[model samples]
Target chain A: MVALEFWFEFASTYSYPAAARIQAMADQAGLTVVWQPFLLGPIFQRQGWHDSPFNLYPVQGRYMWRDLERICAALNIPLRRPSVFPRNSVLAARVACAFAAEPWLPDFVRQVFHANFAEDLDITKPDIIQTCLERSGISGHRIIERALAPDNKDALRLQVERAVALGIFGAPSFLAADELFWGNDRLEQAIAWCKVPSLVGIA
Target chain B: MVALEFWFEFASTYSYPAAARIQAMADQAGLTVVWQPFLLGPIFQRQGWHDSPFNLYPVQGRYMWRDLERICAALNIPLRRPSVFPRNSVLAARVACAFAAEPWLPDFVRQVFHANFAEDLDITKPDIIQTCLERSGISGHRIIERALAPDNKDALRLQVERAVALGIFGAPSFLAADELFWGNDRLEQAIAWCKVPSLVGIA
Candidate 1:
């Protein structure tokens, strides 16, 4: 069976919708999903972007907000625009890295995405993150502390570097083998590809 | 039965994928799809954009090319980067407008999108467009002539103006009732929303 990897950033709004739907779709298609969470701050800084591209372009940002609302409403998901643009996602990414091997990692990532984009919560705050982790019955402090460890930080850096090497510059990216699908909307195509390996390398 | 409108532009890359798949998906969902082709130039100009957002941002443009390749491969679709960036789509848009009510309109739009982005053809050339129309079993001269008619030009402009009024600033936008889904990736969500009228206007 072909396995698909979902590389997401907690600070990304579109990742929220992708995360919420990817697993169910993958299951229906009989594919394995690997959740890989990485911070987009490093990538954005490398590109000299001070904020999300949507925010950098006002028109794009306006359309994005409305688009997200329509998607959430159709999916029957609640959403509120975050007040703080581009909140610190380093801690969240770290927690994700530390729990990558755990069974609940995917769920944790989805919850964080929802918390930040749907509930409009500051996912970077210790209390808010701790509460989110506690709700999932995990030790937030332990996860955060472990995430800050030298090895874990190095691993996260390496992950971002790999993404750069793989030609990825955005969130909600999917990797099916060597192919990359960027954006939340490509999630289905990514999954569909996993069902038929013969379809790879078409052009 | 609910009718959903798919508004796409020829210069849009992702629209090729959605245009190819939407019909099959809509059929499965028991929904009617109204294919609407409109020029994105007016919309972009109205929003103060000189080019596609991808072209405006270098990093985005580079990543988009790579991402499109990966997606095309996964979908078993042929794709090649267009030689010309932002080809003058006026002729193609006009032709599309002329055939908007015809059954072959969807195939024409799909073929043009694929030809522009996949085959790397010069879509602005009348000969190339004429050839494409001929291959699709449509009258190239008649369509082009009708496209230039005063009424058809007015209709195209009116369609673009309507898009601006709807707050759409991008191509590949899907509208189900009053709900709007932006981007090629949102095709599925837009179709799904059409199934449940109660979800409309909730956003």
Candidate 2:
């Protein structure tokens, strides 16, 4: 089975819906899904945006919240507007990065997303990260300690650089053999590209 | 049965595919489609973008082109990269705005999109606009004169303000009542919103 890279930012609303279903889709398509968590903060800073684009552009922001609600409804996923928009996702990203190879990594990723989007928890807090890690079957503060290790932090930084190199400008981007597809809507297309790449002329 | 307002910009690459398909979708659903031509230039300018966001962000721009190619290929639509990133669309927009109520408006719209995206013709050229209009069965330069009238130009300006008031920040946006759905991907959701507004909990 060909591998499909799922690039997501924990703070991104669309990535929530994406995370909820990508595993099933990958399993069905006989493809391996590699979940890569990255920070949108660095990328946005490069674009001169100090905040989420939703906050930077209020009209789009309002539309996004509404759009997200509708999408979550359609997908049968529970969602709530967190009091804090784009809660600090560094710790969440670091956890995912540190445990990228663990079989339970996707489970942890979803819990982090749920904590931020559904439970409205601050993902930056160590307790929240620990809870998510524990829910995925990992216990104690050691996991969080490993997640905060300098090497793991550096790995995530390099991953964001790799994402930029691959021309990713948005969250929930999918990469099927170097070809990038942006947005939650493109998940199907990316999967298709991985399953039947020749049809898209993707060599 | 209901009205779907399709907001488009001739210079927007994504709008090309959108213009090609929206009419057919509207027809099949027994809906009225109101074709709206607005300048993204003015809107983007307000956002401090002097050029197409695609031009300002080349990484995204590259992904967009490849994605567009795949989309066009999927739909069996022909496309060529225009020499100009975003040709001055005012003339084409004025023509669309001038003939908004015409039954052939959608036809003219598709032709203009095909001219720019498929034929790689400069849509801002009078000859090109005239050609598109003529192909849609309206002959002669008289229509062009009417399209260039002062009131018609003002009407187009008013229409753009209406679009902004409606919270449209990009092209290929659909408005089902007060609900704004952005992008070609959202077309189906917008239609569903119009058809079954109840399921979405949209009032």
Candidate 3:
């Protein structure tokens, strides 16, 4: 089975749906899912944006919320409007980064997305992410400690760099055989590309 | 047959594919295709943007080209990189607005998109738009004269304002019973929404 890299940002509005349903979709297609958690702040900063593009453009931001509401409802996923747009996701990414190699990382990532988007909880706070870690059946205290460690912080930073190197400007990006697909809407297409790399004429 | 309003801008990159395929797809789905040609320049101005968002954000701009290449390839559509990022579309839009009530409007719109994207022609030029109009079997000279009339110019302006009133922030947007779906990727979903509006819980 070809390995598909699922590059996501904890604060991405679209990533919530992709993170919620990607694993099962990948499993059914007999593809190896590599869960990659990264932050978009650095990437946005590199693009000279101090905040989310949605915030910068009010019209686009308004449309995005309505679109997200309809999409979540269609997917039968619970989504509460977050109080903050693009919440500080450094901590959440670090935790996921600390456990990227573990089998439970996907579940933990989904839990974080759910807690933030479904519950409207602030993910920047340590306790909220701690709760997500616990719900995923992982040691919350040990993982949080490891996640906040200097080494883990550096690891997470490099992960963002990797996303940049791969030309991922937005979240819920999928990398299949070196071809990049951005946005949650492209998830199925990405999986299809993984299933048959030649179909897209990607050499 | 249900009517699906295809709201597009000549300057919009994604609108190329949507315009090219929308009529045939809608005909197959037994839906009426309403070709709405509006300008995105005023819409972008209202959003405090003077240029395309893709150009404003370089990384996104770069990814857009690559993504467009793959997408056009997958759809078997010929695409040439336009020398200009977003050619001025006011002239072309006015022409569209002038003859929108005519039956051959959709074909003319598709021809214009093909000229801009596939042939890399400058659509802002009267001669080029004239060529598209001739290809669609319309009187190029007469229509061009009517299109540049002051009333037709104002008509195009009001069309843009109507787009803003409808809360449309991007091109290639579909309006089915007032529910908006943005992006070419959502074209089929928009058609589905039109076919079964109640299933999406849109009242």
* Best candidate (score: TM-score): 2
lDDT at B15, model 2: 96
Estimate, for each residue in A1-203, the C-alpha lDDT of model 3 and write its tens digit: 78999999999999999988898999998999998999888888887789998998877898888878878988889999999888999999998898999988888999999998999998999999989988998768888898999988999888988898998989989999898899998898788889777545532
DockQ per candidate: 0.33, 0.48, 0.46
lDDT winner:
2
- Once superposed on the true structure, which residue ranges of model 1 sit more than 4 Å away at CA? A1-3, A20-34, A66-78, A102-107, A149-155, A192-195, A200-203, B20-33, B45-49, B54-81, B102-111, B114-119, B136-139, B142-146, B149-155, B200-203
Q: Which 10 successive residues of model 3 chain A have the least lDDT summed?
A: A194-203
User: What is the docking quality class of candidate 3?
Assistant: acceptable
Report the TM-score of chain B alone for all candidates. Answer: 0.93, 0.96, 0.96
For model 3, state the Cα shift of residue A163 in Å.
1.2
TM-score of model 1 relative to the true fold? Answer: 0.79
Error of 1 at B98 (Å): 4.3
Task: Kindly state the number of residue pairs that clash in model 1.
Answer: 0
- Judged by whole-model lDDT over C-alpha atoms, candidate 3 comes out at 0.88
TM-score of 2: 0.97
Worst 10 residues of 2 chain A by lDDT: A194-203
How well is each residue in B59-153 modelled by candidate 1, as lDDT tens digits?
67887787677667767778888888888888888898877878888778777887898889999988888877877888788778888899988
